[model samples]
Target: MGQLSKIEWTEATWNPAVGCTKMSPACQNCYAEAMSHRLKAMGVNGYADGFKLTLLPERLADPMQRKRSTIYFVNPMNDLFHERIPASHIRQVFDVMKKAPQHAFQVLTKRADKGEGFVASYDASHHPYLAL
Candidate 1:
């Protein structure tokens, strides 16, 4: 997760948390998991847990720190709406996105049911750009 990204859909990627369990056959070739293993082997701090559902609180405020406006692919490496992530933590992530409107936060979760439930309860007025 950094200010610059090669992903065509967005300008940058921000991982408030990383790592996820395989949800389906599509996840068999998970680039994130493979990369996390490599990062863990290389001693990169965040991947220490190596594809486990690990949250990085320090990275939460990353977008707010950058002066330039950007399109942030939030949690591109992991499912933010994964069952393992707490409701409060999900709210916290949304809260950060709400506070930083200069940036557009895109969240795509394989857990559509959980994602829908969260969205139904979340105040859309507060987070206009937090697209699920």
Candidate 2:
């Protein structure tokens, strides 16, 4: 899972997983949902469920090897804090971010409560790269 970016804020986008179900009004016209269905039809490997939650462990370490200082938009295709995702996997993602201190990781989540827990679990000094 090499870095490939389309947005201005980040140098690249990485999806450890794809496919996400709508959870709030903000998801009414989710880009991921549309993209997932299209990818599924094209026989892309990760979207078979078409917006159902899925995990991609193969992509977990993507940030560690990037040579440049980058801004990574974590899980732009889905919410990392979704209940369906395991805490252990979330921690792995965090661990990668911690290791890649040269990169800035922006994690946005509609699940605010879960986001709070994520922040509380980490040592602030070790994860200076994470931003809400």
Candidate 3:
């Protein structure tokens, strides 16, 4: 009864936040959007607003307790670099990932501009995969 997920390169998914708007044809049938609405109707606390960008700070620490070295899809249900998400919150997420080195986090975003901005501000020591 926690976060819902599908298989990917990662061992599992972690949706610290949920909901998103479509920005491209690739998003025509966003799985996040569909999942959000379903979870909303099911009365999931965070999805009460259904697809509106909301931060879930409570879920931030979930990765730290895991014993396995996992590849975590940073957020399958939402985009971490959405414009609506503040930089401070993004930093918090990154901080968690940095602390939990046992888990490899993968984040995908359709908002390339916002993604670029996030990359520009990220600490290179913690995130060497960043490219401008």
On lDDT, the leading prediction is: 1
Residue-pair clashes per prediction, in order, are 0, 0, 0
List runs of model 2 lying over 4 Å from the truth. none
Candidate 3 C-alpha lDDT tens digits along 12-85: 77777887777789998888899899999999888999998888889889888886788788878898888788
lDDT, candidate 1, at 103: 83
- RMSD values, in order shown: 1.5, 1.5, 2.4
Please provide, for model 1 over 78-114, each residue's C-alpha lDDT reduced to its tens digit, 9 standing for 90 to 100.
9999889999888888888888878888888889999
| Candidate with best TM-score | 1
Which scores better on lDDT, 1 or 2? 1
Model 1: weakest 10-residue lDDT segment is: 123-132
| Model 1: residue 33 alpha-carbon error in angstroms | 0.7
Model 3, runs deviating above 4 Å: 1-6, 128-132
Task: Give the per-residue lDDT of model 2 (tens digit) for 16-46.
Answer: 9776667889899898888888988898877
Better of 2 and 3 by lDDT: 2
How big is the RMSD of model 3?
Answer: 2.4
Shift in Å, residue 3, candidate 3: 5.0
Q: Compute the lDDT for candidate 1.
A: 0.86
- Provide the TM-score for each candidate, comma-separated: 0.93, 0.90, 0.87
